[model samples]
Every structure is written in C-alpha cells, then in structure tokens.
Target: MKLATQAIRHVDLFAGIGGLRRAFDAVGSHCTFSSEWDGFSQQTYEANFRDNRKVDGRDLRDVQAGEIDDHDILLAGFPCQPFSIAGVSKKNSLGRDHGFADLTQGTLFFDVVRILKRWRPAGFLLENVKNLKSHDGGRTFEVIRRTLEEDLGYELHYRVINALHYLPQNRERIVIVGFKEPTSFSWDRLVLPPIGQTKMSSILHPEDGSEDPEGEYTLGPRAEVNSKYTLSDKLWNYLQGYAEKHRAAGNGFGYGLVGPDDTCRTLSARYYKDGSEILVKQDGRRNPRRLTPRECARLMGYDDTFRIPVSDTQAYKQFGNSVAVPVFEEVARIMLPEIERIKKSKPQTLQAVA
Candidate 1:
C-alpha cells in the first residue's frame, strides 16, 4: 500500500528516546529538531534517529528558538512529575515552592510558549496525564489552553485515549493537538480498532513458538525478595493487607493484581522502583512479578526493532513516559486530509525583502 505523501514535518521536545518521534514518524512525518535531558535517552535517540546534532546536543531551556526553523509541527510528551496525581500529591513536601504558580505551570509551559511565539510552528502535539484537567480545580489546564489558544491563535482539540485500543496495556493519556489557524479538522470520524480481545498472553512467546523474544513478563529476582522471592502465602497476605487499607479509605490504587489472561494498567517509570502495579505471573510458579522492560515496550506498541538500542532502565523510562505510536498514527491519518486542505488553501509565500 502506498503511504500518505503530504508529509508533516515536526520537532520533538522532551523527546525521551523518540516515542513521540516514532509516532509521528510512523505517520510519514519527518522530525527536524529534538530535545532530551537524560544522557541515556540522548544516546538512544541518536542511535535510533541517527540525528547527532539535536538529539545529544542542546538543552531545551538554553537553546535559542530562532535556530530551530522550518518544522511544521512540534511534539512534546512534557514532564508529568509536575502535573501527575502522584507528583502533585507530594508537592509541598519536596521543600520547594509548588503548584502552577510556584512549581508546575509557568516553568516548562512557558518554554514551549517561547518556542511557539518565536518559531510559530503550524501545529503542535502535547501529551500529559489525564489528571492535568482536574489538578488545582482545573486551573492548570485553563492556563495551558489560554496560553495556546487565545495568546497563540491556535485551534485546539484534545481527547483522552487509552492504549488498550491499539495495544495490550491499559495506559491512558491526554493528547492535545493544535493548529495555527481555525482548523476544520474533525476527529469524530477517527476510528481505531480496539485490542480488547488481545491479552498479555498474545504478546508473550509460547514455549514452542518460533518467535524468539528477549524475555517473558515473569517474576524475576529482586534484592528485597531474596531466596523467599516468590509471591508465596506470606506475600499474598501482605498484598491483601495493603489492599484492605486502601479499600477502607476508598482508594483504587496502591496494589493491583493483573492476570495473564487480561490487559495491564498503566506502567510508570516507578515500575522500576518497585514492581507494584502490573506484576506478571511467574513461569511454572504461582508468584506475581513485575513486567520486564521489554514487556513494557511491547504494551506501549514498540517492537524489538524499536528497542535493542537502549538499556533496560532507559527503555522502561522512555516507554513509560511516551505517547502510544499507533494512537498518534491514527490521529495523523485523520488529520492528513486537513493538512492537504491547508496547503491548497494557502500556498507557501516568500517573505518580503527589505
């Protein structure tokens, strides 16, 4: 099948190992600029994208906006620690000024606005936690909308899409797309096949299956677990104790018992800290284990080709902090016609010379 030809050019910010970049790239888009803070991510981005100049080079906060030119779209999976439910809950205790005014809003969002005002790219795609809507009684989102819409003159469309639609994981995120002009883009017709019938078992390699996968999502050794590492009777009781407390307080989080026959909940970078959320069943044993980094990549719709270049820790962090590739690809398919309409309506014009 022939691919979409009216390619969209883009820049990626907070480009963790190019997850947003991969999404846009899959849709036939070209990425011209990328900014990432972590050294491992920088190395992985360069290895995958082969763009040494921007991938490992400049810091987003220090780079001058004028130098970044000729990109039609800007993509950012901006830091969520400032806006996530878990992050916002522990804000005041960090011994720092907090909230939108002191901590979250004005800092990174301002950097994006500075680029928007200076470069004025044709469109932008930004991702954040779904809780960003409710944080500070919705003021944080209001600030972002005001900055992007009224101040920058962009028509914005946003929706919370779950990764289970295209993958075996239950990851959910809010994706906001904006255009420089009053856009006629209609997302109502956008339809993506739900992978509801797909379970974690489908992604795993069968004992005799030909596919040679790196690892299975089974219980592995943990320093704390020691020789008693298996989720034995005592461990099950501990999980029950934790669950009971949260159940009493009406909390839905803390510990989750995911079944191999079903999908998993959201995977976070903290999954590495302690495999609390989506632990897998051990092979030949009954104990629950944390999904390996490779499994996390699979749930996030990344293949072995997309991995094999980053370390386990970096891979987990990048996938955990990424936009689902197929999700963005579907949006791009929906928006392609609109992009063509844009070009037909107003062809490129040469700036007036002094």
Candidate 2:
C-alpha cells in the first residue's frame, strides 16, 4: 500500500519494542524520537532499528514537553496498566487505586496531553487496552475526551478494534486518533479484513522442516520447535488442577488450548510466568507448550526479519504488551491522508481552546 508522499515526522512514546514505530514505518513516516525505559525492551528496540538516535532510555515523566522534538504526528500507546481491566482488578484486589486515580502510571496520559498542548502536532494516534473506555465507570474516558476536544481543541476519533480481524490472536485495543484542526477523520475508513481468515497456523511453528532455525527457539537444521517450549509434567499437572478448582468455583480461569486451526487468546506480559492464557495444543500428552518468542513476534504481526535480542521472558512481555502491527498499519493507512491534508492546509474551524 502506498503511503503519503510527503514526509511525516512522529515521535514514539512508551515505545515497547517499536511495534508502533514499525506501523508508522510501513507508511512513509520518519521516527524522530523514541522513549522506552525498560532495559530489555530498549535492547530489542535498538537491535531492530539501527537508526536509534534520539532514543531516550529514561522515564518520559522526567522529560519536559519542550525537550521533545517538533513533529507532524505524535504516536503513543501510553502505559495501559492503570486503565486495563486486568490492571484494575489486580490493583483493586490489592486495595490500590486505578485509572486516573493511580498517581504514578495513570497520570502519564497528562504527559501526552502536555506535549500535545506544547507542539500541537497536525495529528496524533494513541492506543490502549479496550477497557480504557469503561474504566472508572466511564470517567477516565470522559476526562481524556474532554482534554483533547475541549482543553486542547483537537478533533478526536476513537474505536475499539479487534486483532482477530487482522491476525491470529483475539486481541482488542482502543485506538484514539486526533487532528489539531477539523478534518475528515473517520473510523469507517479502516476496513478490517475478514475474521478467522488468519489462524494459529499462520504464526505457530510447524515443528516440521517448513521453517528456518532461529537459535534455541527452533532446533537443528530441521528447525523444529525446541523441546524447552513444551511444558514440564509437574507444571502441566498443576495448571490442570488449578483450572479444575477454578471451574468448580464457577470462575473462568483456565489454560486456553488451541490447535493449528483455532485462534489464540490475548498474550499478556505475565505470559512469562505461566503461558496459561495461550497454550498450543499437543498430541500424545495432555500437556501444551508456550509459544516461542519468535512465534510471539509473528503473532503480534511483526515480520520474520524482526530480531528478538532479549530473553524469552522479556520477549513474551514485550510482544504481549505490543499492539497488533497490521491493525495499526491499516489505521495508519487511513490516518495518513487525513494527516497529510491537515498538514498541508490549516483548518478554518479550529475548536476554541478552553
């Protein structure tokens, strides 16, 4: 797909392994700045992209808005831990606040707001978990909407897009797109591919002689899935017992078993602890295996060329925390023309800044 002919400079914030960066790169945008603090993730990001200048390995909170480079578009997935359903539940169980109530991570959105207010980029794209809309009984989303539309005067549009329509995983995330001035920005333009078109087979390792070997992930010249990926007998039995207990308690906690034809559940950061959410079905034994880090990369819509410079644990977390690339790629495709249009000519109907 052809991207905008004109160059669009964008900064990557909370840039986990550069998933968003790859999406914008799919179109013809230049990443002028990037911020990611995690050492492992930064390692992977740096390994994948050679042009890693302006890549800050510090807390974005410490950086002032004036410190950021001027760009036509701002792209941020922002930390979703404070607003995500799992995050909220985990915090609530621990008797802690969530959403905008949590001071540390929750208020990071304000930083995005801070930068938006300073540079006033022609357009921006923000992504988060699907639960962000209903977090804090809709108050969280309300504040976000008001901040962009009322306070900063940006034309905002958002929607919860499912990755099943474009990938083998059933991940859903809310993408918020905003234009500095009024323009034709519509969600209808992002035409999603048919659901179930892609299956586990697309991303899963065949374990046969079909793929190339990638160090320990795949074995020998045949490149079969490494035996290490298969769960041990003790852990497999424990997970089954735990699932049975939860089932008896009328709780929905269990390992997701999927074959080559089925779709997998959302990959999470905790996948490193236990690959319960998404376990590949195996024959002969009742046990299933965790997806290899390379497979996780493909599951996140990253191409084979993308390097996994980190450990398996960190790779799982990074890809789990990443946005589905194709989904965002299509979103970028639709947003590019609008971004280009807005950049070319200033809009007359600028919303009054509050």
Candidate 3:
C-alpha cells in the first residue's frame, strides 16, 4: 500500500466525516490539513481523527490559497448540488439557477480552482455526482476541463465509476484525477469486485442474536435493530399509495423496498426525514425499516470501528453525503504511483535550473 518511501501528505477540502481521508490514509498518505465548515461534521471529524493537524473551521472561500499547507495531493468532494440530478431538479422546482449560474453554491468550484492555481499540488482527486459531466449542457464540465488543463497546466483523467461494483448500492460518482506531470496512470488498474457479491445482509443488523449490542444504536443484549427504525403504519401506507399514483402517471418515482438479497438505491441526505429510498423488507405482516446509522456507515464502506459521535439525523446526512470508501480506496491505489512519480520528478526539474 505504500506508494512512496516517505509519507505522502494530503489536504482534504470539504472533508465530510473523512471519507476520502480514510481511503488516502489506507494507502499510507498523511493528511496535513482538513477543512469542513459544518460544525457537526467538524465534530465527527475531530472525534475520529484526534491528530495534531488542526481541522480548518473557516469557509474555504474565505481562506486564502497560501493558508493551506503544502501537500502532495488535494482531495475534495466539494458541493455537488450545482450539478447533481436531484439537486438540479429541486432547484428548478424552486425557480433557482443551478450549475455555476446559481449565485450561492454553484461558484464553490472556483475555490478548488484557486487553490490548485496557487498551490499546484503534485496531484489531486476530485469527486462529484456523475451528472457533472452533463450539467449545463456540458458547458460546466468544459470550463472545468479547460481551467485545469489549459490554464493550470495539469494532465487530467476522469471516469464515472459506479459504487455498485464494490458496494450494495447503486451510487455513481464521477472521479477526476489530475497530475502536475503525466506518468503511467490508467483507469484499467481499478478492479471492481463482482456486483451482487455483497448483499444487504452484510450491512443490515442481524436482529437474530448473531451480533453484540452497540451503544444506543441497538436495544437489549442481541443488538437487534432499534424498533424506531421500522416505518410507521401510516408512513408505509402513504408511500405505497404514493407509488401507485406515480405508476398510474407513468413515473418511476417510488419507495425502494429491498430484501437481503437485493442491492439498494442511492442513499441520499433526505433519508433522515423519510427512509423512502432504501427501506429494508421485513417478515410477514410487519413494516419495513430504515437503516440504522451504524448500518448506513457500513453501506458507505465504513467499518464499525469508525465512531458516530453525532445525532442520528446528522449521521444520516454525513454518511449519505460521503463518497463510497472502497471506491475511493481503489482510486487511491491507482493514483498513488502517479502522485509519487510527480513528487519525485519535482526535485530533478528544479536541480537542472540550479
């Protein structure tokens, strides 16, 4: 897993609960600076990391480029709302602009550009919704590509990878990898495990006395999923009726009721309000249930050792917003050699001048 003899230093921007950090760290990268503006997310990051490197609390826009410490790589998930399908549709319904036209969130990508322009880390890995390539009729991606390749002068490669290849969820995200200098890097290095090999049963809490009880996340001794996770009669019926109405109108909108053998729909931040997207099926005459926060953690490729020090609602939001960890792990594995090569070539380039 060690890509270099020395630890590869990295900075994390918009680090939600350190999902990307976990992947990079797995490849022996050392995180030097981490930024996450949300107080709750910051708390979770701090609780888990507990390191000497201070987590940056200020907004990324407010922090100047020089403030970020020099590092080998930059990792950012950034805000995806400007380009995500769900986010675009929601904004349109609200009569708001999206995809770099929205005054509020759409401009945050510029922050990443500014940092890259100034610091020019040896390499970077940026992630967002797959729809980013098509956002704003492809103009948004065009600008991003031009800025990174033409203006900033970096070698870029990208792919829209599906987490279903690794996890039991149909989450697709576009990953962008850039290098200060090109090396033998290719997407072919990523090897996806067979789909459907992992099932919902892997992450779902075994209510049948097979697991030990976790604090607050489970009930008495057997660690059965909390009864509160089960959908109420009213909500379940309402969702069924709503799905019927959508079906009548020839719409695909409906709750996702999945059993142990099935994969799940994309987990979203809205899962807190109503776990409609992925409801775990139950035995005869009983209500389906929402994933416990712990289960959600597993679904996102987090091990049980990862602490969830926030409320259930906040936990749901953080995990939902997080990149699939195993997906990033394979990405880091592939990007490591290129990142290492760029760093090694730097001193040689400078020594020629000296």
Candidate 4:
C-alpha cells in the first residue's frame, strides 16, 4: 500500500531480530536507529538488514534519550515477558516479582517513555502480550494509558489483535498506536485477512520435491525434514506422562499436536526446551516433532527470504519473541496516512532542550 510519498524514518527499540523493522520497512519506512540487547538477536538482525546502521547493543537503561536520532515514528516491541500471562504465572510460582515489580524488564517501558517524551514523534507503535491489559487487575494498563494519554498527551488507540487473522499461529498481542496531534485514525482501517485461511501446510516443508534442501533443516533429494526434528521416544513418553498426570488432576497443562490443516498454539521462547506447546503431528508410529527454525519463521508471517543466522535454539527464542510481521504490516499501512498528516501539520524541529 502506497501510503506515503516521502520515506518515514522510524527507530526500532527492543528490536528482536527486526520483526517490527521488517514490517515498517515493507511499508517504505527507513530504520534510522535500532537497539537490541541480546547478542544472538543482534547477530540475526544484522545479518538480515544490511542497510540498518549499527544496532546499539547497550542496555537501554544506560542510554540517554538525547543520544538518539530524530525520527518521524517510533516502533517498539519492548520486552513483554515481564507482563505476559505465562511469565506472570511462572514468576508467581517462583515467588518472584512480575509486571512493573520486576526490576529488569518491567522498567524498560519507562525508557520507551523517556524517548517518546524527548522525540515527540508524529506517531509511535508499541506492541506487547495481550495479558498486559489484565495484569495487576488492570492497574498496569491504567498506568500505561495515563502515562501516554494524560501525562504525555498523545492521542492513543489500542487493540488486542490475534495473529491467527494473518497467520496459522494463534498468537495475540496488544498493539498501541499513538499520534502527537489529533487526526482521523481508526482501527477499522486495518485490513485483516480471514482467520484460518492460512494453515500449517502453507509454512510446512512439503517434502515432495517442491523445494531444495537447506543445510540441515531438510535433507536428501526429496527435501524431507531431517530426522533430528522428531522427538525422541524418551522425551515423547515423558511429555505424555506429564500430560496424563496434569489431566488426572484436572489441570489444563498439556502438549498441543496439530496436522497440516490446523492452526497451532502460540510459539514461545521456551519452545527450545521440548516444543511441548505446539508439536507437529507425525505419520505412522513416529513421534511428533518441533517446527524447524525456518518453519517457525514462516509461522510468524516472515517470508522465506528472511535469514536465520543463529543456532536453532536462538532462532526459536527470536521468532517466538518477535511480532507477527503481517499484523504490524497492516498496522503500519493504516498508521502511515495519519503519520504523514501529522508530519505535514506540524514540522518537527529539534527542541532547544530535551
């Protein structure tokens, strides 16, 4: 969608493997700056986007807002594990702090606030887990809303969008869109494809001579998936036993197995452990398998052209932590017109003091 006549410059924060960068880039925006802390994710981000300037690898808490470059839009899929449901549950079970109480990741959002207050970009897009809205009995979301709307005075709009509308994964994330000045911006402008239209088959390795084999993810002349992806008998038996135990207690804990035509559960950073959440069903007596890193990429709505320059373990975590590309592509598409309007209405000049 051609929404802008001139290129919009955006900064990517907490940029995990450049998923949000890919979305903004796809819509003709330029990424002037990016910051991601993890070295592995930084490696993958660098490998994928040759045009991106050096990604700041430093902790954002140590970086001042004045050091960042001016940009028209700010994009951040800031660390969400601190506010996610699974993360909260795990932290509670461990008697650890979560949400705003978690000192490390929970405070990163304030850094985002620091930049927003300094740059006052025409628009900004923030993404996080859907559970963020309900965290701390809505008090967490209240603080965020007040910070962005009442304190900063940005026109804010947010919605919890399911990636199933654009991909085969049942991932849901809350996207927050804001503009510096009031303009016509509505969620109705988003063009979402029908849910369940895309299936696992669309992203799965066909293993029918349709594609060439990659280094180790697929093998042989037929380009079948390598046997390494299949779960071992020991692990499979253990997962089954674990699920049965949970079931006996009427707990909801279990593995999710799905075939080609079905939509799968959310892929999580912990998938590297056992791939229990979303297992690929196998034929005959073979055990189910985890999705290859390439499939995980496609499952998150990334095209085959995207590079995976890290180990499979890192790849799983990166993709799991990434935003669904198509969802944000549509978001970017709808936000561009308003961003351009606001840019034209109020030209940005560097503040005398920030």
Candidate 5:
C-alpha cells in the first residue's frame, strides 16, 4: 500500500536514537534533516532511519543558521542537562554561571532559534524536563518561551504530560509547541486516546521457555538478586522517608517494586548509576534489580524494529536523552485531522502537501 505524501517535513535536533523521528515516522511526517552530537546515537539513528544517515556529530553552533532549507516542522529535544536535577546539583556551589547564556541548554536553544530564524518552518516541537519551568529561577524557561513567541512571532502552546498516559511508564515531560499562526492550531482542544490498561506481565517476556525476537532486548537477566544491594538500610530509609513525606501531603513518592504485570516509572539517564528509583519485584525473589536499558526502551514506547545498535552505555544515554515517541505520534494524529480540515477548506496547492 502506498502512503500519502507528508503534508509537512521535519528536522530533528539532538536526535537521540531518533525517538522524535520514530514518532513522526509513525505519523507520516517526513524528515528533511536530522542532527545529533553523540556518536552512538548517530549510529543508531542511521541504522534505523537510512535517510538521516548523513547526520554528523557536528556542534550545532557551527551550522550556519540560514543553511537549513525550508521544512514543514522542526522537532528539537534539546539538551536537558542544563535544566535537569543533575544540572542544578552541578551548578549549586560549583561557583559557575548557569543563566540562559552560560548553561549548556542556553547555547543549544540559541542554535535552535537561529535555525528557526533561517528555516522558518511552519511549526516546531520542543521537549524538555518539567523542571524547566523552574530552572535557574525560571529565567531559563522564560527565555525559551519568549524567543519562540514574542521574538519569533509564533503561536505557542505547551503542556506538561506524563508518559504513563500513553505507555506503561511513569514519566513526566513538558512539550512546547509553536505554530506560525496561533489560531492555526488549538492546543487545548487536542484530546488524546485512552491510556490503555496494562500490567507488568505484558512488559515481561516468558521465562526460560520462551524466545524473544532476534533484535529484541536481551533476555539474559530480567533482574538481579543480591542481599547487600536489596537490604540496604540507606535505601530502605530513603524510601520510607519519601513515602512519609508524600503521605503527609496526600501524594505518593514511595518506591514501586512492581512485577511485570504493572506500569513502570519514568526511566532516567541516571538509571545506569542505580535502579533504586524504580525497581521491579519478582515473586519469590530475595532481591530486586533495576530495569535494564532494553526495558527502558520498551517503557519509552520504542518498538523492537527501532534498532538499539549502540552499546548498553550508549543505549542508556540515548534513551535518557529521548522524547517519548508515542507522545509525538499522538500529537501528530491530532494535528493531522485539523491540518486536513484546513486543506479541504481551501483550493489545494502542491505547497499544501509539501
């Protein structure tokens, strides 16, 4: 069956493992360009999206802003390190500057802005941690929002959503969307599909008796068991304290020792450091281990067809660096219907399909 030509084109920035790419790919959006600085992510993106194979690990600053050609949309999951918890911790008492210009993300956004000025794509999608709204006293986020709306004259819409709404993962992110015309799209009316009911059992593959697909996640160690790792007083106390604090406020921040028949939490880049954030509980097991990078991939809604050609270390980094693909796909679906309505209302032109 032939697919309809994309009504819009997109370019991905910080295209880690092409998570943003995969989402658009699923929605019939064509990628006109892609850029990533990490070698491993570049490799994985190339293996999966052959058309984006030319993307090099070039510093975005080096790319002349006006060099990018005309495209329909731009997807930029810029570096979140500048606004993440880790970033704040690093900046705290580090005796370093972290304003919009001094931080890493500050610079990346500039590149994106430059590209926006040059390419002037009809729309743009940006992803970042929810904390961005509060980062650096909120100045960092202010600069970003202003650049796109006030400075660039875009109709901006943003939302803070959790991945659990679309997948089995408990993750939160802020997605910023901008259109050339604010009235061009109504962000508020964009409803989503049901966050289907699922269980940990579905995420977990069969025990020794079953075979996973050749390119699927390795089934060597579903989880690890160790007394020292599992029976630590520090972790237990932390979890206990977290639960108490949240309970006091009528919220929940405690550990979730889930089985395969449960939904998971947001996977972090720091997950490689320790899986303490979210550990899976197996029946009759003395210890619980953190979910593997592959599990993280599934939690992020990446299909097995999406190649993780990079090493485990690289895989974790890319996954941490990625946007939830399913989220983007849903956005595109909602936007597509509206775009088609616009197309039907007017005399059709090749540029409309371009």
Candidate 6:
C-alpha cells in the first residue's frame, strides 16, 4: 500500500543515537523534535544529524510538554532499564528498587505519556525490552496498558519482535503502538523475514581486502580485525573457568561463543566490559574476539554509512541501547497507512460563524 504522500512529522523521545529516527526516515517521515539526555549520546546524535534544529539535550522530565513542537506522531524507545531482565536482576542484587520504584530512569515512561496527552498525536510507537511484559509479574505492563488505553483513550496494540528476522543478533523487544482513534491496525500487517535466515556472516566484516579498514576497527590493506578485539589470555581463561563453574552448577550463565554461520546472543550495554555475550570464534588456537564497533553496528541493523563519532565504550553502549533499524522500518511502513487514515478521519476544525 502507498504511504501517506504528505510528510508525517514525529518527535523522538529518549532518542538513542537516532535509531528510530533512521527507521522512520526510511519511510519518508520528518523529525520535528528530539530529546536525549546522555551527553555522549547527544554528541553522537548531533554529529550525525547536524541539520536537526530542535534536538533537546536536557532531561525530558525538566522539559514541559508545551515546549515540544506539534507533530503527527510520537516515537519513543524510552529507557528500558527498569523493565529489562538484566537490569532488574542487577538492581535486586544491589538491594535497589526497580520498575516504577526506581524513580530515575524507571519513571521516564510518564514523560512519554505526558507528551502524548498534550499533543494528542494521531499515533505513537513505544519500544522497550521484551521483559517488560513480565516485569513485576506483569503488573508493570498492566499499568502501561491501562494508562494508554483507558486513561488517555487510545487503541493500543503491542507485540514482541525479534531482530533475528532482520539481523544476526537474537534480540527481542516489545513494540507498543497506539492510535488516537481505532483503525484496522493489526500485527498481521508486519512482514518478518524467516528467523535465522540472516546469519552472522551477513554482518561480520569480510577482512579479505574487499572492504576498506575502518578506523581502529580493522587495519592494513586487507582490513584485518584489529588485535585489540581479541580477548586477552587472562580474560579468556577467566571466562572459561567462570563458565565451567556455572555449568557444573547446572546454571545457564556463560559466554556465548559463535561462528560466522551462527547467530549471536543479545548485545547488551555491558558488552564493552568483556564482550561475553557474543564472542566471535577465531582460527587455530586463537581466542575468540569481541565484535568490532563496526560489526556491532551491522549486528544492530545499521548500515556502515551511519556515523560512529564516539569512543568505543560509548559506541558500544549506544548501539546496545538502540533498536534494530529494520524491525522498526517495517513497523513504520505498516503504521503509515493507518496513521494517514486516522489523520484523515479527524473532523475538520469548524470555522467561527461570521
């Protein structure tokens, strides 16, 4: 189906390095405003999207809804830490509150709600970790659903989508979609390529002199992966012992070692620490290496042309915190037709009787 001919304006909240922006941009949408709180993320975002005029670098809680520009749709991949499995586990071990109780990042969802209520956009798309549905034993999701559906009066639809359909990473995220008025939106409209159809080789750098070496990620005319990515013998031995211990205890906690033909585990923000989640196998007796930042970009469904103007650590976190671009691109494609329908159905603003 043909998408809306008119430009659909969208505001990006918690815009992590503009992943969602790239997705919507693919389907011919314009970003009117954006808000991202991280200083490093703001830097990377500004560097890549220098033309954006209204990118807010401040915390969303401090910014009023009236300060935002009017737009046709709201897009938020809001902070998922409070609702993530790893995040909750970490918090629990630390004896800290999680979910809505966390108060810092946990409460950020309300910011999205306020913007939607104030602007009453034709529709909105929200993304978070797949664990959100089960967080707090499903209480968290219940609150979100009630607020969006009953309180603000929007027709909400959500589903968990895995990135393995589009990229090599086995990442699953919950996508929440809501419309100001009911339309024929359905999950059946989303087209997903067969799972595991895309293998790790698709994203791994060939290193065969075919692709130019990126800065620090690869080297020489042959574009060989830099040695820095290879795990040090000390760390490798430690990880092996740790995995062995866990295995003996009948626990599934261990590093994920993968080859070109195999898909990797979810790349988390902690990847820069040890890269345990996805270690690429090496030839001979060499230790498996962490994916270079470039490979991480590809694993996250980002094209090479997308700028990575940050340190390796920051780039890892940014990519880890981002959504798979192609997954959202398909979502945007399916939503555009319905968004246009909702906009067209709005009653014409009545003129004053002269």
Top lDDT model: 4
In TM-score terms, candidate 3 sits at 0.96
For each candidate, give its TM-score against the true structure: 0.86, 0.96, 0.96, 0.98, 0.81, 0.96
The lDDT of each candidate is: 0.71, 0.89, 0.89, 0.90, 0.69, 0.89
lDDT of 1 at 265: 76
Candidate 1 clashes between residue pairs 3 or more apart in a chain or in different chains: 280-289
Candidate 3 per-residue C-alpha lDDT over 1-354 given as tens digits, one digit per residue, 9 for 90 to 100: 555566688899999899999999998899989999999999999988989866898989999888787788999998998899999999999999999898677888889989888777888999999999999889999999999999988999999999888889999999999998867899999989987688898888887778888877788777777788889999999999999999999999999999899999999988998899999988874799899999999999999889999999999999999999999999999888787777777653211110
Q: Model 1's lDDT to the true fold? A: 0.71
Candidate 1 regions with alpha-carbon error over 4 angstroms = 1-3, 52-57, 93-99, 102-106, 213-241, 244-250, 349-354
Q: Which segments of model 3 are wrong by more than 4 Å? A: 348-354
lDDT of 2 by residue, 1-354 (tens): 659788788899999899998999989988989999888898999999898383698898999777777688899999999998899999999999988889989999999998888788889999999999998889899999999999989999999999999888989999999997788778888788898789999998887778888889998767878889899999899899999999999999999988999998999999999899999988776678999999999999998999998889889999999999999899999999988898779634322222
- Put down candidate 6 lDDT per residue, 37-130, tens digits, no spaces: 8999988888778763847989999999888877888999988988898999999999999999999989999988988888888889999999
lDDT against true structure, model 4: 0.90
Minimum summed lDDT over a 10-residue window in model 6 is located at 345-354
**TM-score, cand. 6 vs. native:** 0.96
> How good is model 1 by TM-score?
0.86
| Candidate 4 vs. true structure, TM-score | 0.98
Q: With candidate 1 superimposed using the best TM-score fit, by how many Å does residue 60's alpha carbon deviate from the native?
A: 1.2
**Backbone clashes in model 5, listed as residue pairs:** 170-266, 199-261, 199-262, 200-260, 200-261, 200-262, 201-260, 201-261
Global local distance difference test of model 3: 0.89
Candidate 2 accuracy as lDDT = 0.89
Looking at candidate 2, the ten consecutive residues that score lowest on lDDT are: 345-354
For candidate 3, which ten residues in a row score worst on lDDT?
345-354
**Any runs in candidate 2 off by more than 4 Å, and if so which?**
52-54, 346-354
